[model samples]
Target chain A: MDLSALGSCVSQVSCVVTQTTSGLISGMLLFLVSCGLTLIFGVLGVVNFAHGSLYMLGAFFAYTVYVPTHSFALAILAGAVGTGLFGIVFERFFISRVYGSDVLMQLLVCYAFVLILDDVVKMVWGASYLSMGMPEAFMVPPLFIAGGVVPPFYLFLIGISALFGLALWLLMARTRFGKVVRAAAQNGDMVAALGIRTPYVFAAVFALGSVMAGAAGALAAPVRSLTAGMGFSVLIESFIVTVIGGMGSIVGALVASILLGLIQSFGAIGFPLFTDGLMFTFMAVVLIVKPTGLFGQRVR
Target chain B: MQAKGTIRHGVSRRAALKGAGALTLASGIGGFPHIAKAAGKVIRVGMNTILSGRVALVGTSSSNAARLVIDKFNAEGGAGGRTIELVVRDSKGRPDEAARVVRDLMDVEGCEIILDSEASSGAFAVHEVMRTRGVLCIHTNSETSQLTADPKMHIPTVFRSARQGIQDAVGGGQYAAAIAKKKKLTRWMTCSPDYVYGRDNTAQFMEYAKIFDPAIRLVEGAWPKLFQPDYTPVITKILQEKPQALYSALWGGDLSAFIDQGNLYGLFHNIDTFAVNLGDYSVLKAVKSLPKGLHSGSRYNRIVPHSAANEAFYTAYTKRFPGQWPTNWSWQNATGAAFMCDALKKTGGKTDGKLLAAAIAGRTIKSPFGVKGTITMRAEDHTIIDYAVAYGITEPVDPYLTDIQMADWGAILEHEAEWKKKKGYA
Candidate 1:
């Protein structure tokens, strides 16, 4: 190739790289959120529509903690632990009653919680948008990746997401609890026959899933404006990610999250007007072509 | 239908029941009971707007302003001793819901006038309802140009008290054009919501900007979905394009996210950003650090009008609702209520829609937000005129906007006429 053409080609490649990196930044955050939805749906056998609200609560809880302590670590901890406890309580009282009921009944319960949670948020936060500025640790300058600039916090998210993924794998594969959880997923009756307290297992799984969502929200707090119903958009995106990744699959969520991130980044660039529908379109195609997601187990 | 034998207080039960039934039938036959109750006593003014969801503040401010005006009017012996009773309903930011709620206010609640405080999305729907209902409506929150500028969409009973996109575009365009000329900035990109108001506002701003300065070119336009939480990708594209300047119509949480994210990416540091909707208290208070040197046209800044009446009203609003500043909707709604009151007063408390419309047509009234201490309800089109539209550089401190520059109404109207002509709008 001629020198000028080669220079242009290199620039184009660099542009692609930059956009991809940007996609990965959001991709990592989505994975953090969607994995929890997948986990909760898998083990709980109930679609947790209130996962988004949990995420919102996580961010607000973090905000509550952060305002007083101003420690990012404490805030994140408060987000995770607070949401985890909230999930336990909700599951123990409301969700547990409708565990084996109709999906619509469960959905109604969740919808009720959604409305109540939104009201509660308004009551506490006063219905105004809030900002918990990036933590001191994350207050670094933008990093250049392949001739494009990006926030360093985004890179931090990617690293943290990777670490979380690893820890999740270890917990699910290396531990006896993971074995029992997997057994419960395969056949809860058999796990019960094997003398396992299936209820405790379900509660633990819900709490764990909620912790994931809380961490994601805490991570996302800096990147987003904390509004009354801010969890909604995250919920929609997480739903999309969960569906595409095959609900209940950690590996699938990670892969699908990145794919979605890239699609959104590229789709926004190419088809700005249809960008809103792009993710739904992707999900529709996936549901049509393969109801069982990439990493999900095929039903008999 | 009454029993033959019954007694209470010197009357049989049958007789009392018969008497009650006759009275009810007579009242029903003579006139609706509601009308009888309303006659010379109360003028129920209906209002419908988003009262729930993300933009509830719009409804809150609009409702509060109307309350402020209505309380004063009622206290002053409202329009010939008929008190103005506001019957407000929440639309939940849904267009169809807004229409339904407005209808309920009119039909179910016996409201005569509609004070539509919906955003553009729901306002248009509410507009259609009022067109058929034929009740005088003063749109208090919508800023979409076609809501007023398009003669095709214009209804006799529907008038706008809020600023229109064309008005702000001309003003903001001229203001930004001057800045661009001084700085010799040519490349421009827009980051606006991907909706009617956003697209129309951005297009108008760009058109007027080009009219004012032919040297500028639109490099790119980023249209994010309304209430879009993440502005990362859009911000990335803008940064990559490296436009010399930018404009955005994104407001509320969307605008806050854009500003905060843009700051992180150094998007504003390099680009001369002019987000017109950035002047709201929501955005001003929400942003992490109010970035310096950002230029925005006034939406609702207390210091812009520089009038005693405006300051007094601001004081009144703050006093009424402490710690919460009145938004742009507050002044517009207050203006709308005042206009309705003035018309009612002119007609000596008549609720006749046509008469009230005639009273307000081309009438200039004292306003807290007016440039010259008065705002005119333009006769040719039922929109506003001579409001204190301006632009200024932003600061990080109180009076967050500095060096406030008011836009010329003459220029705005002149350009607005040209724009209408271009759009084939009467």
Candidate 2:
């Protein structure tokens, strides 16, 4: 090949690599958010409509914590723990009442939570976009990969998400507690008959899911703008991930999130206006082909 | 075929008419006294704005500014001995609610004049209501070019006090073009919200920049979804393209988010950033520590106009609302209220919609932030003209701009008529 041809090939290769890296980072962020949604639905059988709000609250709490302490790590910790506690309270008071009720009742209760949480955020923060300033370490320099300079923050996000994913896997797949949670997800009545406290398991799952959402929010605070309706924006995307990944499967959420991130990153380059429509269309196609989703179990 | 007993029980049409007439007479007498009491006591000005949502700051600040102006007018025994009573209704940033509140303001509250401080979408809906009701409306804070420029949408009774997007775009574009020429930087890109306001503003800026410097070429454009929290993909795309300069129209939280994220990627160090709406105090305060040398145009910086009127208003406003920096909308609403008061004074307190519209048309009124020339309400379009268009580099403090460059209104308005004609809006 001529030098010009070689240059063109090299450029194309670099473009692909950069896009893949971008997709991976985006996917990891989505997984952080969707893992909680799927977990709550898996064990508790309650789709938390306010999952996005919890994510938003996480970011806001991080901002509140970071403002005084100036420590991003502490902010993330406080945000996750604070949101987890809030989830426990919500589950105990509101969600508990609607347990085992009609699906419509469950949806209405969660949707109401979405509205209340959104308003509560507005009341506390006042409706303006806020930023969590980037830490000095993240701003030092960019790392070059495939001729594209990638921000270190992206790598940081990817690393943390991977670590969390592994931790969750170990807790779910290897531990005795994990076995109980998995068994409960399959049959809560059977687990209760086996002398387990099912309500505690449900609350624990809800709180854990909320903590993941809060952590995602705190992590995203530096990368994204913190605004009142940010939860709705992420919520719609999380719902898509949950549906496509089989609603309650963490592993399914992981794969679906990566697929979505790839689609979005490349689709944005190919067709900017149709990026969102493309995702929805993919979801529709998936639902039509496999009614139970890629990783969902069949209902009895 | 009706039963005889039921038919007898039903009142005859004649008796019903007599009873209705008696009730009407009683209502007229009761309402007459209230009408007389309201006649010359107060001039009710109704405001429909987003006061309870994500963009509530815009509405609340605008309303407060209008109230500030109204309070001053009322304190001085009002305009022609009639105190101005401001009634604000929250629109929630929804168009339907904006229309509904506007109707309630006119029909139920009997407001002679209306001030709409909604965003562009809601403003258009409220404008339709104002046209249908024939109520004079002074739009306090919408910046869509089409709202006033589109002849099909324009109503004689409606006028905008805020700066139009196109005007700001043109000024910023020219400023960017000059910098690009001096620095030998031509490759340009845009990252704006994916909506009418964002797309139109970006297009306008690019068009003007190309016009000013024919050597200038657009590398690419990125239209992120409106209020998009994450801007990583867009930032990455810009990096890959390596544009020498970028024009962004993202405002409020979206802009703040982009700036923080872009800072992480060292995007600002590699490129010149010219944002049209970055000079607002609220946006600056929200971000706290913005990268220096980011260029922005046409935000109300108290020092840009440097007039006594502006200084006095700033001093009074800051004192009244401590620690709350006045936003661009605050000044725009204050300007609108001032213009309305001038028109009212000219009309000798006559609140007739058509007459008030006529009184304001082709009239020149001094704004608190005006630079000697004052703003004119163009008779042809009923839009404010000759508002200050200034661009400057961002600084690390409150009111964030330094070394300001002011644009001549004549130059900016030169192509506006032709541009509107090309868009089929004139």
Candidate 3:
């Protein structure tokens, strides 16, 4: 090939690499947000609309912690723990009362939480948007991979998300709490008959789901502007991801998030305006093909 | 009225009280006629702006500026001894919500005047409500040209107290085109939000850029969702295309996020990024690594007007809100409040919508941000004119902007009128 043709080939390769990395970066954040959303559905059999609000709270907590400590790692931990603790309290007071109740009641309760938390956030953080910015560790130079300019922070995001997914998998698969949680999800009455203290397990599961969302929010805080409506978009996107992945499937959430992320990244390049609609279309197609989702089980 | 300001010319405390007492006798508090009630009456002005969404900083600045102006006016015994009271409400950046809030403000809250600081998204809705309600309204932050420029959309009671997109487009195009000429940059790209304000601003800016620099070719236009959490895809696409220059109309949190994300990809290193909204001190200062030499239109930097009045306004604003510099919305709302106060003074503190609007039309108010110490409410369009329209290169340090280039108002007017005619708005 001639010099110009070679240059064109290189440019195409560059475009692919950059777009792929962008997709992964977005996908990882999506996975973190939706994994919890799906888990609530999976274990509790309740659609927690409050998930996104909790995620927003996590970001605020992270900001509150990060501002004083000036440590991103510590902030991430604080976000997770802060949200996890709140989740426990919420489950104890609100979610607990709605167990075995109508789905509408559960939904109403969670929606109420969303409104209350929204106001609480506004009262605390004020109405203005905020940015965490990158900590010093994540402020390194961009890494060039095959003519693609990738921020090292992007790589860190991908790495951290993977680690989180692995740790979550281990917690669910290898630990005794994971076993009890899975068992409780399968047959809460049977476990109660066996005297496993299922209420405690339920609270643990809810808090665990919240922790995942908090970590995602904390991770996203650096990359995205924090605002009162920040979680609204994420919640919508995560719902789509959860639906496509199967509402109860962790592995499905991961796969769907990555796929949707890639689609969004490339769709932005090809059809910038329709990128928002493309994912919805994808979800529609998925629903048509598999109403139960890719890995979703039948209704409880 | 020619320069010092509309009503700021040597009006002392005693003189204001005297004028107030005289107006009370002459007007009898616009037919209230009860001395006790008239002495305690206040003109209520309502504000509906984004206070909880992506652009909440705009509302914060706007409300703060309104308070600054209103408090000063109230302290001076208001317009002829009547105090002006500001009632601020958050629109939350939704159009439907803005309309609802505005209706509530007018009907339930009994606000005689409205100072709207919504972006174009919500401002359009506010416009419809104002048209229906016939409330005297000053759009303080809605920069969309059609808000005032279009005759069909005109309400005699409504006036724009902020810069219009066409003016910025003309001024910015002229500013950016000069550098493009010097650097011989022919290829350009745009990444404005996918909305009316964004599309119109970007297209107008590019049209004028191509006009000034004939060699310019717009390679592509990337339209991002407003308040989108990420701009990586947009950045990557721009990087792939490798345009010599890029322009975006994203503002507030979106702009801050875009800049932060772009910095990651080294997007601005080689590209001459000209973002119209980047000059807001909060947004500019918030960028993690604000790339130096980024071109932007003046958005309430105290240095741009380079006048004592402008400096004084900035100093006072900063003093009022410690450690917080005013955004573009601050001065626009300040000017809007000033316009209202001056008009009220002219009308002997009458709250009639048409009467107040008539007083506003074809009048100039003294502004720290004015080109020649005053900005005019044009009689034709009811939009502010002669406000300093400028562009500058950004820095990474304090003041955050340098190499200021002022846009010629004559050229701006000539092109704007042409643009208006082309759009059939004239």
What TM-score does each of the candidates earn?
0.92, 0.92, 0.90
In angstroms, the error of model 2 at A173 is 1.1
Residue pairs with colliding backbones in model 3 are B5-B366, B20-B80
Clashing residue pairs for model 1: B6-B12, B6-B13, B7-B13
Question: Candidate 1 chain A vs. true chain A: TM-score?
Answer: 0.93
> Where is model 1 more than 4 Å wrong at Cα?
A1-17, A276-290, B1-34, B132-134, B152-154
Interface RMSD for each predicted structure: 1.8, 2.1, 1.8
Q: Which stretches in model 2 have alpha-carbon errors above 4 Å?
A: A1-14, B1-40, B151-154, B420-426
lDDT head-to-head 2 vs 3, winner: 3
CAPRI class assigned to model 1: medium
Q: Give residue B356's lDDT in candidate 1 (0 to 100).
A: 91
DockQ of 2: 0.54
Whose lDDT is greatest here? 3
Question: What lDDT tens digits, residue by residue, belong to model 1 across residues A59-123?
Answer: 99999899878898898899989999999998888888987788899899998999999999998
